[model samples]
Target chain A: MNPIRQDFPAFDGLARPLHFLDNAATSQICRPALEALVRFETDDRSNVKRGVYARAERASVAFDDARKAAMEFLNAPSPEEIVFTSGATLGLNTAAHILQERLQPGDVILVSLLEHHSNLVPWQLAAERRGASLRAIPVTDGGRLDLERLDELADRVRIVAVTHASNVTGAITDVARLRSFCDATGALLVLDGAQRAAHGPLDVQELGCDLYAFSGHKCFGPTGIGVLWGRYDLLDAAPPFLGGGEMIRRVSLERSTFAPPPHRYEAGTPPIGGAIALGAALEWSMAQDWDRLGAQERELAGRMLDGLASLPGCRIYGDTGTQQRIGVVSFELEDVHAHDVCQLLDSDHGVMLRGGHHCAQPLMERFDTVATVRASLAPYNDGADVDALLNGLEAVRRKLA
Target chain B: MNDALYDQAIIAEARSRTGAGRLDAPTVTAECDNPLCGDRITVDLAVQDGAISDLAHKTRGCLLTQASASLLARYAKGGDVAAAGELRAAIDAFLKGQEDERFAILTPVRNAKSRWDCVTLPFQALADALADLEKRG
Candidate 1:
């Protein structure tokens, strides 16, 4: 048994054994994070940054501490650079709206084909609203981004938004290379780290990207919370995303002034408890041996790919090469609808898999399929979970055949 | 074989491939696709004297969808085109766990809630084909 599996309460609470393979969508929240949430709600319950009482002060300190934790997690330059939002979708939308001021007519917003709808749609709406064009960085047949074509749109590219790791294909993008391109072409690289944030440490300064966004729920934290880390200069220059309480410096009859970058981006009373829980989640994640976990995930991914390949009439998608991918595997069984496969896997084998486009419909188009059955892994998954998935798929093959 | 959703009856019907062809100069044709699973079904009909003289189908889908299409084609031949529109309603009721003897062949898929669209794609295409025929007259 994997030692990490003991930390999650879902494994112990289940009536029957469950093979949870949908971690890429949303992971099971860890014990520390859940405890932090309950403790905060019970002990230090108050509106932050408003009341002068002791509980309110504690809430304010915890919220600020959570920001510092997020800043440290990303290895960002300063805590002032991290802004909390509803989730990654809102974070990307905020980035797009902030960058929209710089986008002139006929300028281009370059996004890759592997982006989730969160990363793709914001830029699309921004381009439409600002009279700019949106172009996709084409993907190769083996699911790698085609970087050779960067020069084709080099002149007019204003912003380059790409995913750090694809949810569907599990292919990890080379952001360092993408950063170098952005350095030469003067494009701001916005990385969607929703899928990659939990896999390993992320250093915004080391990656050399202008902005990064991620969700807390996908990283074993609470929902309704996310982080948007940007360069201080870029964030200070951009306008406030939402207008309300807690983001203003002064209000007058004629005009109003906004606060600094991080506070300006946070409009309303923030998710104080959620932020505290996410801080605990980040602390718990940082304590793990990521190098060992990464190796284990790669080994499990390789085993899953080999097993699926040996199955008759199974067509696995994306880069089967485990070197540049995470444990997310998307595949189709011959003559089996993805929904049917998922249903049978759950009902008979207690194996939970995701079926559909994985929220990347354009990427699905690139693969020439409507949907694929995806089984993703996390640190807690062990060989038993993989065996359950394999056995379920084999049973489906024999019964359907 | 334990707790398997796809029974031998449904598998046999799916693999039978009965009425699996295109009709020559068909009077009405309709196609539908379940985009989530990429299952497509096309229904072709030759209507003469207000009756379906011939019924055929082409499908790219799972065993459940193929079985449903085959069973529909087998039962729908020589039936009135106007009556084909009722097939969709009957399937709708059947999927809601209703007992309809006409749609009893779909009982194997009753518990598979997510796949309700699979068992009804062909009937939906037939309903559309009937509507198209009515528009022409």
Candidate 2:
């Protein structure tokens, strides 16, 4: 974690030793990303696509460069396939909206129990609006998608939307299985890539997904910026989600024509600086040695799982193994409430943890738990972070349970 | 930080489980959920005139929520709806860090602003119950 920790500002010069184990919520911004944000704001503070001056042209160039970076990071076929959004929530909403017209009554959108609310609700709205329906792919006790049941569930599924990686259980979905299902049924695949984006560069083409949505902040970029990538053919055929300046081809009193895919989706002025920063963040991520970082993450995750299981009355939700999972771990102590556990950890142990339904209420129900304490790891987190979390849980149990 | 927010007294109050049930025959009942954390409080009341003859609570939440439920029972068990009204003010004061002898155990909670709803959910259900009863009559 040495060189990785040095690049993140959150670990710098802390008065009290702070262990940030809440990276699933938002990772700390890296130096390059933050510098990119500042550079955009200070050096080129002008509107994109609508200005002629040098600063405006510079801003526009930087903005498009960021788009190219994102396109390359996701391994998207073209830069035009990338649409900058406010965050994953909005990106998913745009995905739903763009795909809405294709859905008709009796059509189904298959989502899994692993979804964050951002991934679940927008499709629900789309289903409801189109007189279509949503069917959840039941999660196994291990918290992975019960993909064995996919044969029965995919009959009416015009679209299969699911998480690339679960924020709660840390289980990575078996996308190959889903890819097969979608291919056989001709159901479009849409991935909520929020959690998986943090781990490494994505290959949407390789994953066999038509559209993908992910937040920048969770990938060491700024908030209020995210990316939605869709195939050119699908995007070209889709309706405009938002109608405004950059998104329109021409406007009249009664009728207005829309621009192409990405622009048609990104209405109004985009988060210029935020998008630039996210690109820088993606570039920074691509520059890292994922093989080394990934092993470090897995080792830390195993320790967290084993340590939590060792504690009396402690239960780890989802897969307890390091295989096919990210470093995000959610667990609970008997009798002690999740919020209380988190509060005590932060106040007493200086460990920052997130506790709640994790915006996946259905997943919580799947686990038959009220709330859970989640410790999500990033590249900068080390053994000490895992130690503090385990120690904090022990202290919390002694005090409360 | 020296004064632990989850001190002994608060723990005891939560452990007591005072008013931690449902009234079999209730004049009115209301449920409230702290949407942020999914902490829930269901309050049942037996009212005679404008007074709450008895009350019970089912709080499926954290320690602060349970402790607050217990405190709501302790102070407002036999009191009128107006007295329950005053308790809401007291909770507001406690949250504002103002001194209330009975609720002093929760003073430390003022600094933990995110947990404020946990301490207020029971009282909010009671308020809703009272308002619902009024609407019924």
TM-scores for all predictions = 0.91, 0.98
List where candidate 2 sits over 4 angstroms from the true fold: none
Candidate 1 pairs with clashing backbones: none
In the range A126-215, model 2's lDDT, one tens digit per residue, is 999999999999999998999999998877899999999999999999999999999899999999999999999989999999899999
Q: Which candidate comes out best when scored by DockQ?
A: 2
Calculate the i-RMS of every candidate, to one decimal place. Answer: 3.7, 2.0
* Best by the lDDT measure: 2
Poorest stretch of ten by lDDT in candidate 1 chain A: A5-14
* Cα lDDT listed for each candidate: 0.88, 0.91
Q: Write the per-residue lDDT of candidate 1 for residues A1-401, one digit (tens) a residue.
A: 78887778787767788799999999989888898899889999899999899988998898888898899899999999999988899999998988889999999999988989999999999999999999999998878788888778687999999999989888999887888889888999999999999786689999998889999999989999999999999999988888988899998989789999899999988998999999888988888999999999999999999999999999998888889888899999987778778878988899999988887888988989878999999999989899999999999988774
lDDT of 2: 0.91
Looking at candidate 2 chain A, the ten consecutive residues that score lowest on lDDT are: A1-10
User: What local lDDT score does residue B101 receive in model 2, on the 0 to 100 scale?
Assistant: 89
* Per-model tally of clashing residue pairs: 0, 0
